[model samples]
Target: MRWPLTDAARVVAEARVRQGWSRVRAAWFPILQAAVAGSIAFAVGHSLLGHPYPFFAPVSAWIALGFTSDRPLRRVAELSVGVALGVGLGDLVVHVIGTGWWQVAVVLFASAVIARFIDRGAMLTTQAGVQAIVIVGLPALGASGGPLGRWTDALVGGAVALAVAVLTPSDPRRRTRAMARVGVEELAGVLRTLARGLAAGRPSDVEDALVRGRASQPTFDEWLDTATGARDLARVSPAARRHRDELTALVQAAVLSDRAMRNARVLTRRALPLLDPGPTEHDLHAVGATVVDIAAATDDLADSLATGRTPDRARARLVAAAQRLDPFVLAPDDWQVQSLVLLQRSLVVDLLEIAGVSPRDAREVLPPI
Candidate 1:
């Protein structure tokens, strides 16, 4: 009873600590990005063009728009184009129609509509509309510097933003590598939980494994996306590219292994309702032990992927243990033996493939489990 209460308290405490850390770290990323953008905009606009408005305005707009989403380039381009069109249209309209509510309404509406059409171009509409207002809404004490000034400013700001984005770009390869490490660690965690469930012969353990397997899918998808993006960026180092590919394959293999494990869990759960006449303690322990070994091997494979280091020793040990659990050789009637074999085979195939060995060659080296 005390143990359960203590465990609950500890979980709560850990959750709070994690929450606090996340909040603290969250600010660092956005602020650092914003500052970098602002500095670049200022330097380019103020020093080179002698016009700070061009740099600051576009950069500020990018930051305000939250360019950190999945598509930073698209967002920046959209907003910059929107502003440019809006400013250009507004200037053109003011020249044609004298300042009035109707003129303002017309320019805003026209700019918004054109902006919408310009790029996929939802923001273009807003961009043009706002620019129209800026050009004609305010009264001028002195002669207008004209549309040229506004256009120049918008162009400068956009150019600065684009330059910053292209120059100090975030490498997708690095992101993939980071995710691989986390994914592998998570794989290890999942395997441990799964092994425990199988060992206890509980339907709940199998169900939990299924749930974890589903949850893990996003990690693989995200890694794939990052890898594809990084490969496209072509800015990653040669070592990074190779490593990224290896990690990608490793994750793909993990997904397959997870699926196999899931199927085995389902079988185990189904067997739970069926009556087992009698089983020797030794037989039961063997089932549990085999499941744990399978998990350990899978975890080792995941670790290798995360760290770029192969688990040669663990792989060998797993191969040896899997052979011992062979249904054809060891325990013929044990259904658990069949399930364990499936997991073992799936993981071995994936691991070997990730190591760049051919499937036939891997089979030659790996004995049937």
Candidate 2:
């Protein structure tokens, strides 16, 4: 067996290659922003302020920017405040006790605990700990040998970040669309896997699909959070005003998709036992085909969400596929079988609702008993 570190490296490397560079592609814009933010912070702190070196400015900006898809202003402000708090605390402690191994431990612990006492945000708590370490590890006097200059630099960096956020904001709609796409694709993937497992009557395949479905919950939650942030940004940021409607739709989509994923997980769990060896090759060809079609429709709708296109045909196809799953005819004998059909139909309705259909209309698409 490989060493644990090597195994971890291998897993990370493999993940890099998975998903067709989608993850890497999504990072380019943020990477560019970070580089630019760093440059801007350094320029303002050093050239403008005549500081020989203003390291913390750029560092603060980078830490604040983070990798969040939305909430730039809030993130930058919270991180800046946390950094200031930590630096102030560290400076006070160092002034009294001087810097040493024991001093470093005390400052870090105090700074972190105080930050937690002040706020519960992850960014705030992290920045506090990190800034305390920076203060204890490095000299208190910032470039130009000025006392407490690090705090000023941090303020400058945070101000620049906030300015950039308001002036040249990242497109929250695009990020929301990306999040929604990931969530919808996850659902489609699970459904497609379920279809394949059912068609082959493989209990193992069904079990694997169930695992996949359960694993997709985090993606759904992330989509909801990202969409919520986007909606909030769109509401507040004047630059994002035009995207308000789209962001709102994405927020609604996040909710609908979450419910659909829940139903999908339930369906996958139920399908596993039905496909056990005792069933002796139950013919699920037609139902499987319909499920696969629903998956295709889901993918189509997901792509449309990303592109802001009308998925009229896909929605119609989804409605038709859902309508075909007549539980009375398909799973009359077993309640377990009937439950799966109902759950699949419910999933389709949720997707339809996410596609802009009214709730009542979305449910009406299902076949009559």
Candidate 3:
């Protein structure tokens, strides 16, 4: 017999290749960012003569600058104020106490305390405390002149960072679009998985789906962020607007499907006692298998959406599976039947809506709703 080791190794190698590609791309971003920051610092320092604190200002300004015009101006303002306050506090502590280990202790403690007191930007105040320590510790800079020079430098750096951010704004719109795509993919996965469990009508499969869904919540959050950001990008084109709406609707539909699947699973578990005679068990198992097939189709549809194609077959099968589950109403377990019917109907309607079909069309597609 041929060994399976080679096949397993191939699978592992492919996974590593994908992961390495992602990491390599990510690595380039920080390198580019550092280069830009360094260039600004050097240019600003060289341009201004009497400004004396050129290097500090450019760096500070760059730090203060945000990626887009959309970033809150308030944040830059907060950053500037925080730096100023920290530098001032550090200078004050150094001048009053003089230099020693105790002075260092005072600076750190005061920085931490001031940082905490600032409430919103604790990092700012602590930075100020550290600046004070530098002022006191470095004899070459001296106690008097050095503190002022450092503060001026800090101001210059903030200004440079801010100016760069404002002048060469990066568009966040593409990032938002990418995020929306991720959300759409996740919604599809959950729906497909649940659809599979429904078709199988097996409680164990349904339970497994629940675990998968919980793990997807972070992806849901990421998608939600993308949707919100896309909306904020203020795109005026009809196509862009429509895409945003579709993403929003997709998230809603996923939520509805999740709820419906959970309710249906609970109903099935409760109805297990009533599965009864061998013939009913056989029929139920058959129905469950159909549900599983439907789920597989849904997963395919999700894959289609990611690839920019319509999943018409999956859509049709989902509606058909809902109809097949309808006869469960005739079962002896009245409560279970009612619950399962409710959940099944909800999922069918949501899935249809995602396929751009109206609720009425979905119900008509059902088998005698």
- For each predicted model, how many residue pairs clash, with residues at least 3 apart or on different chains? 6, 0, 25
Writing each residue's lDDT as its tens digit, candidate 2 over 21-88 gives 55556667776786788789989988888777877778777777765546467767788778777766
Q: In model 1, state the lDDT of residue 315.
A: 68
Across residues 1-369, which tens digit of lDDT does each residue of candidate 3 receive?
Answer: 122455435534543454344334433553454357546655554464344434444445544553323333345655655565556566666667667888778777776676667656554664556555665576634422254554665665666555554555444344433433444444444444444554555444444444444444554464455445546433453434546555554455445444544544454444344343344443344434544555565565555444445768768777767676565443335544445555556656666665666778877776674
Error of 3 at 201 (Å): 8.3
Name the 10 consecutive residues with the lowest summed lDDT in model 2.
Answer: 11-20
After superposition, the stretches of candidate 1 with alpha carbons farther than 4 Å from their true spots are 1-31, 35-160, 166-169, 235-284, 307-325, 364-366
Q: State TM-scores per candidate.
A: 0.60, 0.77, 0.51
lDDT to native, each model: 0.55, 0.76, 0.52
In model 3, the number of clashes is 25
In candidate 1, how many clashes are counted?
6
Candidate number of the best TM-score: 2
Q: Candidate 2 — which residues are off by over 4 angstroms?
A: 1-24, 43-53, 69-144, 279-281, 331-336
Q: Give the TM-score of candidate 1.
A: 0.60
